[model samples]
Target: MLALAALLPLAGASFAQQKIEQQMSYEQFKAAGLDRLSPEQLANLNDWLDGKLKVETAKAAETAKQSGGDEDRRGLFLATSREPVDGTITGNFTGFGKGRSFTLDNGQVWQQIDDVSLTGVKDANPKVKITPSVIGSAWYLSIEGFNARAKVQRVK
Candidate 1:
């Protein structure tokens, strides 16, 4: 149904009897070699037309969900390559020049994987932000007021 409608804008023709001839422009149909097609070949292609319609329907539904038509679809607007997670660290953050694990108050546990760390911040329950890598699930954590970002991964 949607594939037909998409072609409608290009063809400027109305549909009839599930036939592209009535829906597609004459030049476009000929360009696709439909004019040279045998009746059996055309019937075979038409038999698979419903698959195109299904793909188009799924695309439309995803577009609607991403556009906020469904309020319950949280994180739809965030990049799939990297997502943002923010919370308070469970303990006073000390510098970790090697590796360490951080447990957020929200129960998300992340472990540092890099060799960079910041010292001197002794505040309890400091705010933390974790941004995953732009290409994959590899994550980095940054404590509020700190300058260094450590490579991290979710442990829980």
Candidate 2:
């Protein structure tokens, strides 16, 4: 049900794109006092409606994309963290440092954005969690065994 709700607006957006003139019969258009509108006025109205539809479509796409069950595709945008994500490092897990990039098994790559580091620790395919900060949009990446975590930003 929740998935359907997320997709409903996207479906409506494509179907609701009919031009204003095409949405009504001639008599209905004239009855609405729209017949008196100049050609430019009607054009302006249609353009405005199109612009609004575009905005709504973009919003709907974002909402649908954010609906869970798609963890593999997330953290590809910069400076935005909607929720926590868990995945393992693709290969060897070395300690983290500023400017270091970690590629998850799901193919999402996160780059360290802070000066924090966890060195002298080595593990292969260590499980990790990337969590969003409470006060802001910042995110932190934590390895399974290490106590240190680094502030991270999605780069891919």
- Best-matching candidate per TM-score: 2
- On the 0 to 100 scale, the lDDT of residue 16 in model 1 is 21
- The residue-by-residue lDDT of candidate 2 on 31-144, one tens digit each, is 667778899988887676666667765664566556642444444532222457899999888798889999998788999989997788779999999976432246789999
Give model 1's TM-score versus the native structure.
0.47
Q: Candidate 1's residue-wise lDDT over 2-31, tens digit each?
A: 333334211101122265565467897887
Itemize residue pairs with steric clashes in candidate 2: 76-156
True-structure RMSD, every candidate: 17.0, 17.3
The Cα RMSD in angstroms, rounded to one decimal, for candidate 1 relative to the true structure is 17.0
lDDT of 1 at 65: 46
Instruction: Specify the highest-lDDT model's number.
Output: 2
Global local distance difference test of model 1 = 0.59
Off by over 4 Å in 2: 1-73, 76-81
